[model samples]
Target: MAGANYTLEFGLEAATDDATIIARTVQEVDAALERVIAAASTFNHNPTAFVVERPRFGPLQFPDHGLKIDVDPRLGVAALAWVGPDFDCPWVTKSDRPVPGASLHKDIDSATPFPDDAAITLDQLRAAVHEFRESGGHRPKCVEWQEADGW
Candidate 1:
């Protein structure tokens, strides 16, 4: 079956811990998935027929499979992406809310290919989040591809 890419972005305060951040991120994802199911219901599609891969916290695992969720607490940003079966649903799109202190890189382009080895460890993720926040959410100037390419 053909697959489609999806991403969900949200903001969180820097003072939040890893557990809280991950919990909140998962909750947002769950709500979005529910919306997708609801929307699909109107079209006679069985939303449950599509297998869902949930996100895991603490460390990145099985980088080659399922749904992946990443967060940058410093930027108060969280992102969720799916790499499996296409949902063929219209509700899966960019977030409508304006995330405060979020860089344009917050969302992953659905067309861009994600590498298998790109997984970052929990420590690395936390460090990057800390660094990004410490830097005041300033994104480096991109001289090559467009700004969205950096995300």
Candidate 2:
């Protein structure tokens, strides 16, 4: 079966000119990516991997899977993109159908196939971090998906 492709892009605006938050947020994102990769490995034969190309400046790679995280501190934005074999795990795809799960399914409808664990996990982590930053008076903004070609 052909693998599915996905991408997630988002930005944040802090109340203050805190350059430190950039590094901190990047660290948090890296940790979250680790967790997602771990979860994906259980189900995917070729589990996605996390590789940081640069400390704070990223072009994080998930080798062989064409996955990468591109972050732009100037724009306060990060874009994650993946293109690889479809996750055939029972939890995610059963008989080529998606199983309903947590809030991750909110954006998906009955007709829409469920996204892989990696995508869900990444989205959740992003949302969580965004919320945390918001609580600290930082504004989460421009959460959107971009085409792989565009990224």
Candidate 3:
């Protein structure tokens, strides 16, 4: 996990707590995920999916250079997505939409909304996070991707 560079942004408690938590290593990211799940379980309204991002290396902005993880701890599932140049998850059949499909974090940039199609398991979410960390923040190829609208 040496030299790992990534940012984990949370949107659960904007009015009462810090909105952003930066995780610079794999362990920190794992910890952040754990914290997020715990927070969701205790809160009533599900939070907008949190994001993992790296500093822009080129012209990437907004939906680019980031992987969004919307975890539903109560359901033990999550949605993973990203958007950028040629950067959308490929379609793999449609499924029920996850809660908070399009997450908006107050005071922070809104995460790219996920479509109604895929909801990955917790284990899968962990793997995807690892892949995102390993890839230095590029959208992970570990899971199938569907291109977002206007992509």
lDDT of each: 0.28, 0.29, 0.52
Higher-lDDT candidate among 2 and 3?
Answer: 3
Top-scoring candidate (TM-score): 3
TM-score of 2: 0.23
Identify the leading candidate in terms of lDDT. Answer: 3
Which RMSD values do the candidates have, in order? 17.5, 16.1, 6.2
Identify the superior model by lDDT, candidate 1 or candidate 3. 3
Candidate 3, superposed: residue stretches over 4 Å from native = 1-17, 41-63, 85-116
Work out the TM-score per prediction.
0.25, 0.23, 0.59
Over 19-70, each residue of candidate 1 has an lDDT whose tens digit, in order, gives 1222123345455433432332132211111122333345654222222334
Per-residue C-alpha lDDT of model 3 across residues 1-104, encoded as one tens digit per residue? 42356455544542333345666667876776776666643433333332354334456544345454455566676665554345444322123554444332
lDDT of residue 18 for candidate 3 = 36
Decreasing TM-score order of the candidates: 3, 1, 2
For model 2, state the Cα shift of residue 4 in Å.
Answer: 20
lDDT of residue 45 for candidate 1: 14
Please give the distance, in angstroms, between residue 45's alpha carbon in candidate 2 and its true position after superposition: 26
In candidate 1, how many clashes are counted? 0
TM-score for candidate 1, please give it.
Answer: 0.25
